[model samples]
Target: MAETKKTSATPTKVAKKEKMLRVTLVKSPIGYCKDQRQTAVALGLNKLNSSNELPDNSAVRGMIFKIKHLVRVEEI
Candidate 1:
């Protein structure tokens, strides 16, 4: 008779920690790219002096970088 071998179960994946960034609209979005305006809107910033807290992910960072002249970002 031959013996059978058993394998261990698959390991569980750990969820990554999500960081946050506080973004504030310091300048107007007038004359800015439509995409920039959209980004600001998505961030809940429609007017100057407005602010929002967003996830500190690549996509959000990219958006902030594009409108760095219009917004201020601080680590939360």
Candidate 2:
């Protein structure tokens, strides 16, 4: 047998948050490996002193690691 129950309730708000990583190009990527230069561009850094706020995730972290010498990373 199947039975049905009635209930009235309000859903509470749930906030989901993800940490952010601040990446900035501090040095020139010229003379570096092409792949490393590309990684820096892919991270939204096209020029020295350029900065981008990216998600603090593995993918972004990997990109940063690839161009670590050309950029600086901070957690926000």
Candidate 3:
């Protein structure tokens, strides 16, 4: 027979935390590829020097990578 382990009812200290990314539109997307422009816009960067705080996830990272030449990314 297998033995069962006892468990405590105490709450765990584990907490869910979301990382944030500080993205800024450092350069203009004009004359660039259409996809790059779209990506920049989707990231909430519509003007030069404009910044947006977004979740640090794969989707956001992908968008940033697509327009790396037109913007800058920093972790917060």
> What TM-score should be assigned to candidate 2?
0.82
lDDT of 2 by residue, 1-76 (tens): 8998866587766987889999999999899889998899899999889999999999999899888888888999
lDDT of candidate 2? 0.90
Write model 3 residue lDDT over 1-76, tens digit each, in one string: 9999988889778878889999999999999889888898899998899999999989999899888888888999
Better of 1 and 2 by lDDT: 2
Candidate 3 residue 14 Cα shift, in angstroms, is: 5.4
Model 3, C-alpha of 41: deviation from truth (Å): 0.7
For model 1, how does the per-residue alpha-carbon lDDT over 1-76 read when each residue is reduced to its tens digit? Answer: 9998977688777997789999999999899789989988988899889889989989888888888999999998
Which clashing pairs does model 1 show?
A: none
RMSD of each: 4.0, 4.5, 5.4
* Candidate 2, position 39, lDDT: 93
Off by over 4 Å in 3: 1-15
Worst 10 residues of 3 by lDDT: 8-17
- The lowest-lDDT stretch of 10 consecutive residues in candidate 2 is 4-13
What is the C-alpha local distance difference test score of each model?
Answer: 0.89, 0.90, 0.91
Regions more than 4 Å wrong, model 1:
1-17
